[model samples]
Target: MNFLYPGFLFALLAIAIPIVIHLFNFRKFKKVYFSNVQFLKEAKEQNSSRDKLQHLLVLACRILAVMFLVFAFARPYIPLETGADPDKGNLISVYIDNSYSMETVNKEGNLLDEAKRKAKEIANAYQLNDQFQLLTNDFEGKHQRKLNKEAFIQMLEELKISPASRTMQQVVNRLQQEGDSRKNHLVYLLSDFQQNFVGTEKIKSDSSIRYSFISLKANALPNIAVDSVWSLSPVHQPKQAEQLVVQLHNYGAEDAADIPLKLTINQQQKAISNLNVPAGKSVKDTLSFGGLEKGWQKGVLSIKDFPITFDDELNFSFRVNSEMKVLTISGDPTQQFLKSLFAADPYFKLREMAEANINYSTFPEYSLIVLNGLKQPSSGLAQQLKSYVQNGGSLVIFPDLDAGAAVYTPFLTALSLPVVQELKTGKPVSSSIELKDPLFKDVFDQIPANMDLPIVNRYFSYLERNTAGKESILQLPLSQSLFARYPAGAGKIYLSASTLRPEDGNLSRHPVFVPLLFKVAFSSAKEQPMYYTAGKDDLLEQQKTSVSANQSLVLKSTDGTEIIPEIRQTPGKTLLYIADQLKKPGFYDLKRTDSVLAVLAFNDNRRESDMRYARDQNLKDLFAGQQISVHNSEKDALSLNIEAKNSSIELWKLCLILAVVFLAIEILLIRFFNKTKNIQKP
Candidate 1:
């Protein structure tokens, strides 16, 4: 047993007062004449012996009462085998889960409110001088420092529901960083313990710190969430048909049927549908909409869900271009096939440049660059095109058959494409087409058995080596590739074996030429991510834009919240660091001074959408090697439990009770002894 305030033990000296009073008779004896009778002598002897016994008994009781009283004031307690010493000041770190999932209700009310109450109770269990650190999912800078009891309680009152969420390990790591090393450290985590909280692996904890998990329980609730969404069309055009795919997930045990889903674009209703999602599974549905103007389109997909509604709606954004730009760099001035094909439609703005007069600086402005028989391709042009394709641009290469292998080998090698080995003069018809590939998907309504495939008269056979990202769109006899698509970093490269000359086969004028080239051109438009998660996606990436050294980019939200993110320029893109700035979900415009550069969408993380919680045993198993305790939320009065766990068994209250009992014994002894003497006299 240890004493909280050992200095109070000095009060034990007061016990000497009772001993002195008993040893020396302080009261003056009154001389009486009634003591002369011989018969009273025998009674005097018996009374003298009984009187001495009663005096000794009364002194012992008085001494014990004083001693017990002093012990009570000293606050004695037995130290538990684990945890910090109760005598010293403690640094307690309490983590309250204020995530979106904490909005769930139980018998005690909302989980977040219950967590706050329990946190206060924990603080009350300790001394007022003990320091406290409050941590939430936001991980604000103010929470990093320690606060006194009053300040900690004030901060707790100000906390509300936040969109941010964290795992168990992250909370532990933050707690470990706080507090003083000399002081005893104790941690309390109050949360509903969602399944995602445990993360993928076991938790790593410090052996010196004692951890207690107060698991708050909630009623079982069925939940359905809008998991994700994506556009089927890679490129968006004005007044064009577009299909969007939305995924729905049912986290409940029973299947959900006829869940109403709605899609809105620019504050106008676009499409509506109903879906059936199975238990613990996901289902996808497609919505078709059109007539979008040439501008930024803010799209919102929503579903009707109860109890947990944060993840019911998803926000997304995309851009619809008014015209597609196509650049053609031709070695032969009279190569009019591509120029005439694209010029027929006003939607395609075709720009033709000769080999010697090509402007290299304007490569990023076009959606697709068509190389029409570039005779003697230079190393500089190849390097520029390589970087363009790798940075999400699309390119088509029609190699000049008359050019030597030495001139073309270096250009093809730089782009990681197969080099031409030898020219074949025999006419070979195309064998098969990859009809199921995404490039050709939905292009053909029906396949004909006697379809006319592209024929090649004189073509170069490539000496292929690496076939990792190569997809053969058109194949010749003997498994030779006539045309294929190669995935280069973020973009794609389409290579054809023959040029657009009359001497070559009719591939340039074939029926498949129109759809094939148009599909590639349409796919060249860089498709940014439709949406980003609020907390998870802190970095926003965009195509590199020229910004003056004095000017800065600002992300302005719909509600007039603006923030200047840190910019980081890379080879072909710019990265903006938006750490913890975005909390709400909606559309935000990236602006340069007065002009809007792009529209970015953000949505809340859906990890908190699932209402499933981890069991006590599961948490114990996660922290198997650590000294952790799990508290049940059903039990009220957490202060007593915390006091017992943190400081071990306290004996001060028991000492006080014993002190009262001894005083009562002293009173009874004096009363009984005096009654007996009076009875003997009668």
Candidate 2:
């Protein structure tokens, strides 16, 4: 038991006043001659006894009333927990969830707003000099330092919803890192308790810090979101038919029908489609649009959804080049088959160069580089090809008939590919194509078993084992690799074991050669991702090009937010990190001064779109062995069952009620006992 103001207990001494007054009642005695002695004797006995009893009873009541009144003013209470001293102040840390999920509104209005209101009340509950800290989802610089009461309140007022998200465990970890372990620490968490964000397993029960969870739950409602978007073709072609596939998800219980989806390119409406999504499921629909203009174009795929508008619109950026530049370096310029293949297609701009005259500096300008019948692979050319592949350029290698193992081994080793071991010269071996591969997808409805396959007579075998990124696209008889594809860095390598000469079995003149070469050229162009998530570590790779003396790259968002990100020059690519600059989801432009270099789409994290929330029981289970209590946001903070000294059970109100009851009894006894008074007889 304790008193908030124990000095007021001296008022209990005032009970002596009632006790003294009851003991020393002074009255003038009037002597009267009574003739009837028998009647007088009986009346005196009865009246004297009743009068004495009433006096004692009233005295007890008056004394108790005074005592109870003094005790009430003292404001005594029982400490909720006896281990801690009530006089000691607390080190308080309050975490308010300010993620996109906090935008939900209920009767108390926005959850974030309500959380701030409750947080302020919590701060007011503590003493002014008590240490305080404020934390949010952003984990900003301000959150690291402790603030005074006034400063903490100001921070709470300035808090807003952010695209970033942190789990419950993260908040606890942050608090632990910044909290004062020596003092009695208290953490008050106010949030909607989204289930995905509740990573309580990462939290350990700490005896030093007490936790209080204030759950702010809104009405459960359904939500629809544009999960993602992808194009039918990986590479974008100018003035060609393209399909944009939009993926939709329903996080509700009911089915959605006839949901209108619109696609816009370069601020112009391109295509629209209607989709039906089932409850707790996902669906994908394709939007066909043609006449794609050359150069960079910003595209947006949008749909109508209630409440959650963040994921309603999906933005993406793509480019359609005027023509695909093919740089073919040949040991023999008389190889007409190599020239005719690329020259026949108008979409392909073929530039043939002798192996000796090839300039490595101009390699980044081409989408695909062909190394045709190179008699010997020079160390300089091998190093240049390695840098080119790393910077997102495709390479197709056809070994010369007399090519040496030593000439190409160093080049293969640099790119983490298999080296040439030995050259085989024998009867023609038929080719077996991988029909279900993405390269051959939709190329043929069904492959004919008896179809004429390409045959290789003279070929090179591998010296090293195949890597995880290496896949055999075409296999020869006796399980030998005819054509293998190896992914090196951001680019790919298509290596054929056989030469392209007539003596090498006419693989270059086969019908399968045309589409195989075309697919390699088409797929070489780097396809930009449909969208990137905000608050994630993402780097946008741009092709390295010759810039003017004063030109520099800059990033600008659709909302007029811009920043010059740190540019990292790697070999043949420019890497720009936009994770820090992507505060919100929208279209952002990578430009050189005023000229837009590339368009990049960013979307908010869809993890918050799910409406599921952690229940009170779930939280309790999460902190089972810890000193924690959970309550609804709308309830009073002080009303919850907590271990803090501020939660003292006040006995003042109970004492005040006892005081009133005792005074009433004292008055009734005085009034009733007076009726029996016999002053004349005495």
Candidate 3:
């Protein structure tokens, strides 16, 4: 027993007041006449015994009232928990695991809902004298500090689960830093063991702290998932073939049954096939197209199952990349070199058309038309070339050894090129090339001039092409081997004084070979964009974990004391999600409606053995060694149960009770004493 106000023991000296008042309780004896003495003596002898009885009764009543008052002042109470904190104790760090998987339902239908109810009851049961610290998955700024009940609850409400993941080892690190080896501390973890959570075993630091792991998701339903799809082979080309190979997976407790699969492209059925895969294993199958046009396209793959979330369905798209059909308007074999390159590429379809002889509309379907060793382009061909360049087509020109300036003038002029300058007796030579340009990215950087092949010492003239209003990409060092060019409206032009024959030794291919034709040609090509399907497993190829969960399942229990799941993995010490651990007591769950086979973590639970629920031993041990026994004389120990304890209340109800008792005692004593007086009188 303990008194809340031990200082009230001083109220016991109050006994002295009643004792002194009773002993000297008197008015001055009034001096009276001598005749009064004789009558006074007779009355005194008769009522003397009665007066002594009244005096003794008054002394007993006064002492009893004083003792009761002292007891009331020293209020006493007994501790519910022996050795427990009536005032102070060690701090408890509660880490709540709030992750997505906690959303999973148990047989009760609500995992987090049940967890919160249990947690609050636990908290309320603990005495208010205990101090606590709250924690969550995000161990930053908030939840990382110590607080009282009101403050701790405020931080708890602010907690939310992130898309990121967490592990026990990461959380143990923070606790190890804050925990003192000399003092007692406990960490309570509450979370659902989603397929990705880290269990308690990986917490391997050699600290003397206690930990408890309350797993949130127990007895969850088995789930299935979509794994991946491989790229379609070009060899499977058919107007009716939309070939995309794919794989599916099941993560059930037991093997799953094979089910039929349907495919949809741009909202229409392209192909359907049944993929036979074993539980925890994946299977591959080819899906073909019904009939579809050429271009980039999108599609969906789906499956049916309860929870509707972890089923086999994903989003994907692929491009047909229509092949380019090109027409070479000349029957020149210099055509063979260029023809072979384009012919080998699947995207380019090359063919030789008749020379452009004034009629040009017959080639509208051709993406580009080339000229080699033919008459220079006429007005109609020049106009057609302008349209093709504007419409994003490419062209290559190789001049004849004796091709005159007048024949090629209209073509160059229509391309917005300067007038051509004739070469003098000496042949010019090319010194170097530009490697930074994209056209030279692959092989153009240092292609040696093909000067050894043909040496035309006296065959053609060189062009002194005008330099006004032009953007030159390459310059031939000497008067002999330079290729200078620029872009016009939607087309580009090149002026040269030599022919395509290796003998010219000054062609763009020889030294100008790099920047002259190839550089300009590479720039004119169009670009294509690529897309990878969502929910594909390859996105997780290098990832350490692969996980799936019910859309309705959350990862942390409410009141945050349950165990979060451990992900599958090869073992080691690692920190997941932001390297922070939540061991607080609260509810934690997940968001986002998409189901994905994501890689998660695996952890150890060696840390869970640390919790000991220590109590405050200071006061208990202090009293155990002392042999003191304090008490109230009216009874043994102090108790407010006495009716006198309520006597101090100024309320009329208490006053009425006292008034009735006081009058009854007084009247009965007076009546009995008067009867004694009558007997003495007779």
Candidate 4:
């Protein structure tokens, strides 16, 4: 038998009080009661023997009762495992989930606050000198080192809710990375155990590490959230109406009726709608707004929901460009067809330049770069175009009739594209349009199946190869690829077999020429989504006007915190690598020289908003082969049942029962002895 608190054994000395009392009684015996000596002596002797026997039995019962009571107070417990040692210190790690989901309020108050309290309790349950580690969703630098119990509790007290969300597997992996692995380690995970983020399937039982799950659950109350936001128009135009769609989900038992939603742009209320969301269902509502100024437009979609408010408002940041910039590079300056095609369009800002005078440094600024009538491509120009097309710029290539396949094959191979085999010139081949393509969608009122296709008198026949992401937008009469599109990193490349000159083909004057060219320019000008999820490794792309090589880009949040992210500079674009430094979600600005270059919005991980909890059985199933346990934080932390070699089974309850039994025997003996005295009265 062992005692959790061996110091309580001092209470066993209390038994001596009863023993001292039994040994020293001062009451005098009455001597003149029995006058008749002979008969009284015989009967008194019999009663005296019985009285002595009863007195000894009662004394023994009293001693046993006192001993049992002392043992109960001492809290004796048997060790479940003989090899378990109490002297060895343990390496304890406590993970307090401080995600936004922990903001839920129950009878015990806020779940995060309750988790912090339980974390302190777990720390107190261990010895003061034990090495401890505290982890949270922030995964800060201090979490990488172990601390004493005092420091661990101090760090635990400083924890606050964070926007970052990590799966259970991630938490375990982090513990394994930073925790002390030398000693016996016990990990306590205090969380609401949201099923979407917990990821039970990924948890495996480890013999070296024991886990205790402390789940904090709130009463099932109705929660509604603006689950997500999208738009009908992928490209935001200056004067065009943008139809925004917001999805509202009700994660409750009752239906939500007449939920008011509002849309605000640049801090001005733009549209409002009332939505009805069915129980355990999602409803999408559409709001239309137009006439946004040409610049960065900050938008917000908000809905009122009780208790859970982190996901109440969705922030949107998007750019509205006034015109599409098209840069046309021509080998033959006299080719007026290329210049005339885009000059009259108010939506296009066209700049034509000769091939020799083309500035490679300015390539990324244009939405589309047209390589018009180039007979032979230079290696230097090909290298510049490769980088341009990969960093979200669009390119259109027109092969010259005089240039051989050898001229363009090397450049095409560098971009993972098929090489042009030979030039074919014969009867004019008509073009077949792909109306279902996004570039052609809504372009024509109705597309005729047998419409007069563009005539191609000369075209390059491309070699056939099994390459992915090669799609034909326009096909020749024999199903040969005349114009095809290939995705290059975040951008695209369009390959045309024929030039736009009159002798090459009549395609320059075809009805499809204007819309086709306009689509290519608009496609490259599409803005990236304004918001990004933190810890998700999303790239932030910003347009660069003019920056020196030594200039640095810094991202600053609304709270005045600044971070230097990985910056990559292209011709007209700058890419920032948001690699895990930004944890909180809010409005952040990419700044250079104290000027706001671009504004970005970040959102908290939405997986926790679902409010689905993992059951105890799910954790058990996940840790099936390991010595693990699950516990509710509502219960006392000291009562945690761990199956280890030195698992303690408290015997205080048994001691209390034995103490009662002994006292009861003492009372029953007193009553029986008194009855015998009454019967023996002569």
lDDT of each: 0.87, 0.82, 0.48, 0.79
Q: How many residue pairs clash per model?
A: 0, 0, 64, 0
Candidate ordering by lDDT (highest first): 1, 2, 4, 3
RMSD (Å) per prediction: 3.2, 4.9, 20.1, 5.8
**What would the per-residue lDDT of candidate 2 be over residues 1-682, giving only the tens digit for each residue?**
8886789888888888978887788867898788888877877887888889988999899888988888898888787653444456567889998888889899989988989888888888777878889988777777888889999999887888898867788778888888775666788898889888885473664665778889998877778998888877756778888987789999888999998899989889999989999999999988899888788878888899887787788878888877889999999888888789988978889998898787888998899999999876787888889888987889999988586787778777876778888888887778888886678876777778788878888898886585677788988876678888888877889998988888987789988888888888888876666678877646876777556657767778867888776677776577887556567877888788778878887788888888889999899888877777888887876555545425456788899999999999988998877585554543
Higher lDDT: candidate 2 or 4?
2
Question: Model 2, which residues run further than 4 Å from truth?
Answer: 1-88, 199-207, 410-416, 449-451, 537-539, 544-552, 569-573, 644-682
- The C-alpha TM-scores of every prediction are 0.90, 0.82, 0.37, 0.79
Q: Write the per-residue lDDT of candidate 3 for residues 1-682, one digit (tens) a residue.
A: 5554668878889888868977886758676554566676777787778787886666666665565556556654453322322223445566666544444566655555544443444344344655567765555655556676667656666656432345656666766666544434545555553323454243354333444444443453555555556554432122545567766665555566766677787678767766555755667778766465675455667666455242346555454445656666663555454565466556556677656443466554554555665655667677777666654455655555465666665566776555444533355444444455445555544556652322333333344465564433333545343334455444444444445555555442443453334344444443221222211111211122323464232233334432333333322111123122433322223222333222122111212111111122321232233221221112211241211111112232333444455555655665575464422232
Q: Write the per-residue lDDT of candidate 1 for residues 335-404, one digit (tens) a residue.
A: 7899878987778999999998989999999889999888879889989998888777889999898896
Candidate 4 TM-score, C-alpha based: 0.79
Off by over 4 Å in 3: 1-93, 98-100, 125-163, 170-185, 194-196, 199-201, 204-209, 234-242, 258-260, 264-269, 275-277, 290-299, 308-312, 316-338, 344-682
Model 1 TM-score relative to the real fold: 0.90
How far off is residue 107 in model 2, in Å?
A: 3.5
- Please give, for residues 1-682, the per-residue lDDT of candidate 4 as tens digits: 7665677677767777767766786668887566567767677777877877777788888878877777787778776432334445577888988888888889999998898888877778776767888889888888878899889888877888888888888888888777554566778898888888767474753566777888898777678887788877756779889898889889878999998999999889999999999999999988999988888888888888887788888887887777878898888888887678788777678898887787889887788999888766787888888888877789998877677788888867776678888889888888887778888877889767678878888888888685588888888866688788998876899999888888878888887888887788778874767688876646877764466788878889879989888877764467788677887777788788799878888877778788889998888887777767788777877666644312455678888898899889989998876455422344
Cα deviation in Å at residue 519, candidate 4?
1.6
Instruction: Flag regions of model 1 displaced more than 4 Å.
Output: 11-15, 27-45, 253-257, 276-281, 416-418, 424-436, 445-457, 461-472, 475-480, 487-490, 502-506, 643-645, 674-682
Clashes of 1: 0
**Which lDDT value does model 2 have at 620?**
83
Off by over 4 Å in 4: 1-85, 144-157, 231-240, 356-361, 402-416, 444-452, 477-479, 502-504, 535-550, 568-580, 642-682
Rank order (by TM-score, best first) = 1, 2, 4, 3
